[model samples]
Target: MDKNYYITTPIYYPSARPHMGHAYSSIVADFFARFKRIDGFNVHFLTGTDEHGLKIQRAAERKKIDPQTFCDEISQTFRDLSKTLNLSNTDFIRTTEERHKKTVQHLWNELEKNDDIYLSKYSGWYSVSDEAYYSDEEISEKENVKIAISSGSSVEWIEEESYFFRLSKWQDELLKYYEKNPDFISPKSRKNEVISFVKGGLKDLSISRKAFSWGIKVPNSQDHVIYVWLDALTNYLSALNYPDTNDELFKKFWPASVHLIGKDILRFHSVYWPAFLMAAKIPLPKKVYGHGWILSGDEKMSKSKGNILDPLDIIEIYGLDPLRYYLIKEVSFGNDGNISQDRLEDCINSDLANNYGNLCQRVTAFAEKNCSSLVPDNTKFNDEDLVMLNKFTDNLDLIRTEIDNQNINYYINFIVSALFEANKYFNDQEPWKKKDDKDRLNTIVYTSLEMIRKISFMLYPIIPSSIEKALKIFNLNIDAINLESIAKHDYLISGKPINKIDILFKKIEKKHD
Candidate 1:
């Protein structure tokens, strides 16, 4: 049996329509899931919406309808965005679904059974925007500036009947957890903040709210709806049929490998979530990475800024792979960065159009012209040939490591760099000029073509469709692109006829109409 690997994006809030940020989060998760599947893991990738929230209730009231109907409509918008992006998630969990409710209730019972849950009256600062409560110490005022309990957003006041989690008691245990597993939180910066915050102090958090009826109802307690954060977080396990321990799906994927989320909600995943799991005597997730945000020109692309980019806008213009490549290619995955059509166009022009697309076209066309429309083989190896192929393969191994680590910025350039080196070798060897020396020229052309194959395999995860087109030009089958096969470097039979190839990535010229 294969290893089980589960991953999830944060359940998006259905109050707002889907945007590029949402797509970015889901796509990151989708890519990792696909890569794991390709690497032979039985992967469970989940993405979905948090249908029960105070904001959903307000949005519904503003639209003169019940929250469920409102959520259904808004949730579809997210689902549509996932499909539009061709995300490969295995399941989509909705908070309003029966399975989710049962799971949430089951978790509540487990915590209660463990004596970690209790009824109490709550009075404190609350941010409906964040669906989080805060203490006076956590909030601060600096000359008309309102900072969050931490960084992402601010907390405002709520007084209601509620249940509390024994977070304070687990602070030392959580610290030990961080000590024992330092890689639990990623990117180093997030890890530091989480450790410092947990060391500062821990407080019992309110787990239910009574102000609204738009959330999951507390078991047998209609007056108090489950807190949106807890209810939303439960969607992760609930989708996999949790609480039914004998169920194959639940047993297989109970402890997720990675729970990817925005930097803002790092506390929920890093803090609240682990405590909940500990209380239930369940194992914590292996890793939780909070990726940075996408900023627009001079501001973060947010709903308030009216600059939140729509993925459709880009997909319609350049298609999905181009946009996907530009996104992961343009920014280093762990850090925050800016994006614009101008930058994306620049990447498409220089990197895609010039380097990758040109290499494929040149190599395939050369093989067709001189090698009688046939692919050449590198069965014979000289020192020069061996050196060039060694350099290319060295870059390929490094690229494989970078891709696995999600280091996108330098990784894509690694491909371009190797191609540049290969281009230089071809130019210096002058394969086209040595038409009479069929064997020597064939060796150069064939080696260059093999480099192209390696680059395409490295690129397959980032730009699948574009790579597919490039592979089609080589007449390579799906099996040819696998890691084991790519490593073997035996793509073309010595005299296998090759097809004529065109540009994989077209140049984007400025057309002022």
Candidate 2:
């Protein structure tokens, strides 16, 4: 059997437009999925909208549309984002879909059969904004109204007939699991926070909400709707055609390799999600990485705050790959990153346009001018030439390790730095000055072209279209753009005329109004 690697972005709640947060998770998942595919794994990348929730129900009410209509409209936006952002997702599963509803119901039934689900009257401070029931300690008073302390969302005290999952009963088991698999949750800080929350003790989770009817119906119960998190979390399984674990996709990709989620939802994924799986006799996903938010200034983005940065707007201004590169390069995966327009311009102008793109233009332009727009054969090897060539070969393992660890900044920063070194090598050699010495110039151009080829392969996942265009200059195809192909040098055919290529990244002018 081929090694299978399955990864998922948490199904985004579509109470509003998809923003940078939604884009961040999906992009990271896409990046890893592409990396794993190139690393020779059978990869399944899943991302979609979480449409069934009180938040959506209320948003739909205000919009004067049925929940499904509201969901469909918003869901389409997220689907479009996947395309606009160049995400190579294998599947996009919405909670409102029949396939997903069936899987969620099946899982609920399994939990009920195990006696881990029971009826109860649920009364607590509930954040409709959060779609979560919070204990008194987790809520605080603000302007004579209760709110969740963590999210500062308004909460209401309500009583409802509900189905409760025996989440508290598995406290010890969850602790043991965390201890045994220290890496089950990532970024050490988020893992510690989860451990502390579980250690402080868990209360049984109300898995059904009777207050609203805009969610997945509880199995065999019409009065109650299955909690949105429960319905939404199962998307990872549903996308694989679960309940029929005998299906080829399910059999091949069960127990997802990782659940890439936002840090705010860490408890739901790390605590409630695992306990539910344990109760249902289903294997847990191998890992859950709760990454931090992309803040729009000092504050976390909220519609009420009028601070949500629409990703489409950014893409429109900067194009897709620049936006992708900025997010991955600027944001520390497990910590909140404040994005500013100025910062974005500086990053793109310095890294993509000046450093990487300028190097490509100069070297390829040199080849065009002197080497007859054809790839030249290396004539002589010098210490600098070998060192410059070795940069790509020597760093392959380290790059693989960084990608595996989800240390994206390190991986991206290394690539940019290597390109800078290549630029320095170009300056030191001065291929333009050596035009009279055809042999030396050919050797320099050939060596530089190989370096560009290697970096382009590494860059394909992050900025696919731009890198594809860059590699096309050397007549490389998508099929030949993998680690194994780039592992060896001298792959570029000598005397093959290169294709005409445009500038990869045009410098962005900063706007100050």
Candidate 3:
């Protein structure tokens, strides 16, 4: 068992400000990274901006600024977002960065050296918005304008002398690789789509764009800039110091554990990325998980749609952890999910305030009054007590299995169910009624406290700040959290003083006009 884990959110395009979709991907990746870290793996988490593309060039031109200047300003918003969202990413690499440029050019030279690349002329329908080349079958005319049928984004005919990657040559090899490693593309549905597309056919890819000057230059071909997808995909490698494959960072986490991406880019990551790695003689990532979009209403969030949900606004209203919890628990991973304000408010009030927060506050307040604010000593475990406590120890392995499979919905559902059970257990036992029987009262308090510790440990990855506050009732900090400790029934010290914590969540009151 290797304990090294590497994960990445697709480096975002900086043509627009960060959106809920960007935040969702980063938060999900951060959740996995945090889980792996607490599970005893050395984790490397990467995210950043894809600053070079036709869309970015046009956006910069519209702003009346140079591409680099535009990138610097726009890219900072993403960096700020990583902080605002409380992401635990280890590195943020921009395509315009010199180090990333070095890695991209190095990959290019390697492909060229391997005869996987050739100088060629390309004529196709190109979508500047998607930064993708579409085949005739993929394009449809809408309102007298040609658009990519899949994305609904307008495309233009382009003819350019450029460099091409031998994607067609690797078509059969890629299919064989996918067949050999069935889990390479996740969620079963996405895998089927990729396999069917590859089986249909693969065209040689255009790897350079002579029209855009805002990207990494082809190694020896100064007149051409590398294709945006190729340059952007290389960020995963560049962040690890590739080309110097023997470097410690590169050697330990080369083949990434997973690349978390949006479904719209599934073709690029699942097909082109793996093919590029194979052609360059580098190991492919373990998995490419293409998650669904975060829809604003019934439609996917887009600027043109005027329905993009700003995560920052949601965080402002509900708080970060609540937002994190809502997204993680409510959204069905690998399926498009809509964000509704009413549902978010309900989640914050029901799940956060009533269930988990009330449990922590009630138990701690009871302990303060009855047990002198100290962790109580239990006399003996009753069947009921053992049953409640065993829920965690029993499912430890199952939780780990689900996390490994990226079964986020399962993991979150387990937590929600556990929280519900913990609340019910506390209510049923009636510790306040057994005040005269000190041992029984102490036992119930001890059991309740232990349940809190276990559930808080499981939740540390999702609602970290709130969990940090909740754990302080046990006088524990972030560094004290560990997944392995959850299996221990008596992890909390008997005589340790429990600190008081502020309300974890203020119930959002409903308004009646």
Candidate 4:
């Protein structure tokens, strides 16, 4: 089995401040990276900003600063966000970096050498906001303005000298590759969407923009800048020091395990990216998972709509872990999910405070009071205890499979159910009433402590800070966590002193007017 895994969050276009959608993608990628690491895989997780585009140039001009200065300021917010979101990304690559520019130019040269890129004139509707071109069919007139129907971004007809990638040449090859790798695009719906778009017929993609001075200059031409998407997508390879495929980072983690992107960019990743690699004779990433938007009410959050939700504001009121847990558990993966204040509060109260947090606090407190603040000794498992413990051990393989498939809903549902069942076991076993039967009391406390240990181990990726606090009862820090430990029922040492834990989550109080 290949134990090396590579994953990425799309290099964000940092024309503005970070928003909830950006936080969601970074958190999801971090969840996977942390999981893979705990599962003993050498994981490379990459994220950064796509700094070259007309929109960025325009935004910088509005602020009366140079583009690089503008990028330097905005890109730092994203880097700060990775830390805020607790991402485990190994590398953060900026397209403006010398290393990335070198890689993009190298890729362009490879495509040019293969006769897959040619000089041409581009005259079409282009959305500077999206940095994408729209064909006649994809554009619609709205109140006298041309707009890309998919994104509702305004487009203007532009005619300029350009270099084009022969995307049309790879249509059949892309379709065949899709047929060969059924899992290449996830959730089935996104895959079908890509196939339908490709079958509709692909046109040679405009790969250079002569009207902009804010991007990497086309190699040798010195007149046009590389198209933003082409320049942006190569960040994945550049982070691994590509063009030096023999480099240790590239050799270990090339052909990324997955690209976690928003659904709107499906065409770029599923279609153009693979085609570009096919032209360059490079291996394609194994999968592209296009997840849905984080909506504000019914509409997707966008600056023009004036509906962008600042994640920092939410983080201020509710700490990082609750926000992280809410996004992963509340939002159904691969489908648009709205972030409601009511729903978020409900999740934090019921799931975090009442279920998991309560279980940990109750178990540790009970052990401290009854078991002399130590791991209970001489645990004798009955059928009930065995059944509760085996929920995790018996399904370890299934859990691994679900995570690999990015069936995050399944993994979360399992944890939620386990949390509920563990609570029920404690209530029914009535450990408080077992004082006269000291032996039975010890067994119940031992089983409940083990339950807390296993669930916290699995949840370490989602809510690290809170779990770190919870794990102190065992003297285990973050480094001590591993998936394999969940299998051993005796993993907690007998008669070892256990520490007390404070409330993991405080219930949000509602105010009555």
Candidate 5:
């Protein structure tokens, strides 16, 4: 109860427009934020765009506009995405913002003062597509030559250059920290990858790129600007009003609960960010989880792969909640998952429309037709109904627990199974056939109303918008239900007229050529 949880989705690079992959990550973080809120923790959820970098500069140049102008336009796209997804992010810190700029410089000065940063000349394989450095081994040769440094990203051998973070010095410290806190990185597979990379060796990472002017200046050094990672990562403390620990925001939420990033940047978050925190003598964030990438067909999605996504298209077709729910619910959060329109349609039809939606539709429809448009009281229940409802509500605590622990697939499967149990119980007790038995019909329909209320409350955290609508369809008010309310043997009152129900989720049909 005393735990303070602050979580952040890795600030997305704004060079590209918002897409399904982007939406998926932010939505997952939002889900965690919601879960923490329901668990009654003081939660601070941060999400934003990494607006300053060489990629943004390049993208701006391609668009024939100043980098800041392009960022302004592109940043709005991300802001729009938040509205589209209904993200409950507490703060959205754009790296280009004035508050973030000051925050980045403060962290830079702290690191420099601690001697963790120093001037160093750099020469290495840099990939513009990734805004990353390759240690020569990662690149390939088509015919006895390294791939010609493509993209406008500078590979010009600059012998006279900017400051470097002495990443090599903290190698042992980082390894020791990981050893002591094995749970620091999630999904064991990602943890193993980071450990192996660290064990192989640590290189003094170049923390400043003088070639790019669209970045934060290196404190008093006018010519050298802080590297994107240094600037970008500091937004964590920035949003919390860092450099002023007395500030309430900082005091309330300093050490983040988790830093969620894609596997592509494990080195940056798991390796570099902690090193930076250690240098500043600040508490490291509780966890850094490098989740798996979303794949297009069999390959990682990219612009060149011609699979660049626009989740907006999906949203316009299926509404926000369904689209949001499917991404997290269908794909296990820790691993690579393929996204196809056809698959989305199937999940919507089978899971949302058929299993979940139809259960509400038929049950409410039966109540209005046979027993009046009101929830009736169940004086007595069949043993079968009792067992099914009991089993369905049994693991309500475990569902919230699984979600908190990020066992996403396990949590979803529990709800789906519960829905199936409800469906079976409803089908077996055909109240319509017992038309002469008024008492039996009332009991059956009333039991269904209570069960529907139970399931609807359980779903509110996951799919709030849908559950709210489902409550209306059942002619029940959501204000009455709580977590404890789901498990009760009897919940509804007698002689309350129930209304006719409609489908909560309609199956989305895929277009065929």
Candidate 6:
């Protein structure tokens, strides 16, 4: 049986348009999903919108449209983003869907049966923007209005009949879980934050709201609606058709390989989501990776601040591949990365256009001119040839290990450094200067082409479209590309005709104001 690898981006809350932050999280998930597929794992990638919430409800009211209709429009934007970015997600779940409603209700029943739920009159400060309750300690006065200390979203005091999940009951168990599975939360810092929060003690969480009618109805209760977080997090399970444990997808992907999310929600995914699963007696996901934000200028991008960059504009200015590669390559996985057009262009021109792209264009253009546009025949292995090949072969395990660890920046930098070394090798060998010795020239060019081929395979996940074009220059097709194909040297068929030379990336001329 193929090893099942399930991954998910946090289902986006589509009260607003998709921004660079939304794009970053989804793209990272897509990269991991694509990498797993290339590594021969059966991958299930999930991304979608969290369509039901007070935020959506209030936004719809302000727009003078019904909530469902508003949600439909905004949710489609997320779907369009997935399509535009070439995400290989298996499902795009929505909270309003019948299938997801069923799953949430099923989970609610399981928690209820376990006595993890009870009704109580709730009076607390709630952030409508975050759709989350804040404790007295988590709230503070901001301009005379109570605000959530963490998110800075304005909160209103409310009293209502609500159903509460016994989150406090599982505090010790959660601590034990963290101790036993130290890596349950990623990036070390986020895990420490979660552990400290849980140790401070968990209060019973409000699982249902009587004030909002736009969300999933609680099982056996028409007046109460399931909390938006519960509905949203259930998307991971609902995509696999949970509640039917006998179902193939449910059994195979129940314990997700990873849940890719931004650091802001680490507490929800790491603390609440796992507690909910424990209440339901379902297996918790293997890892919850809370990646850092992509900032604009010096501050985090937000709609209110008017600093959010529209990903479509970025795509229109620079192609999708560059944007994708920039996020994964330039951004540290667990730290904030401030991105700008200048920084993006610099990385692309230096890394892709100058290094990777220049190597391919220079070598292939030479091959076309000298070898009659054909992959030259490599003769007996010389010491230089063996050393170059060894350099390419020796790093495969290390790259794979980094991929497994989700060390994305390390993985990307390793490939780039290898390409840089290959370029250095070409320069040192001086293949062009040996033109009079046809056999020696052919050997040198052949080695460089094979090294390019190896780099092409490794880079396919980050820059698939460009890599596809690079592979085609050697008359190679996408179907033949895989992890094992690059394990040995010279997988490219010699004497195969090279396609017309095409630059992988065009150098960007920076614009100054």
Give all candidate RMSDs, comma-separated.
2.4, 1.6, 1.0, 0.9, 2.9, 1.4
Q: Tens-digit lDDT track for model 6 on 391-414?
A: 657777887778767899888887
Go through the candidates in order and give each one's C-alpha lDDT. 0.80, 0.87, 0.92, 0.94, 0.78, 0.88
Backbone clash pairs for candidate 5 read 373-497, 373-498, 373-499, 374-496, 374-497, 374-498, 377-493, 377-494
Give TM-scores for every candidate, taking all chains together and pairing residue i with residue i.
0.93, 0.96, 0.99, 0.99, 0.91, 0.97
lDDT of 4 by residue, 109-128 (tens): 99999999999899999999
- Residue 203's lDDT within candidate 2 is 89
Order candidates by TM-score, high to low: 4, 3, 6, 2, 1, 5
Count clashing pairs, candidate 1: 1
**Alpha carbon deviation, residue 124, candidate 2 (Å):** 0.9
For model 3, what is the alpha-carbon lDDT of residue 266? 98
Which stretches of candidate 6 lie above 4 Å from their native place? none
Cα lDDT tens digits for candidate 2, 25-63: 888889899888877889999999999888888899999
Clashes of 6: 0
lDDT, candidate 1, equals 0.80
| Candidate 4 clashes between residue pairs 3 or more apart in a chain or in different chains | none
Q: C-alpha displacement of 468 in model 6, angstroms? A: 1.7
Between 1 and 5, whose TM-score is larger? 1
Ranking by lDDT: 4, 3, 6, 2, 1, 5
In candidate 4, stretches whose alpha carbon ends up further than 4 angstroms from where it belongs are: none
Steric clash pairs (candidate 1)? 126-156
Candidate 3 vs candidate 4: the lDDT winner is 4
- Give candidate 3's whole-model lDDT: 0.92
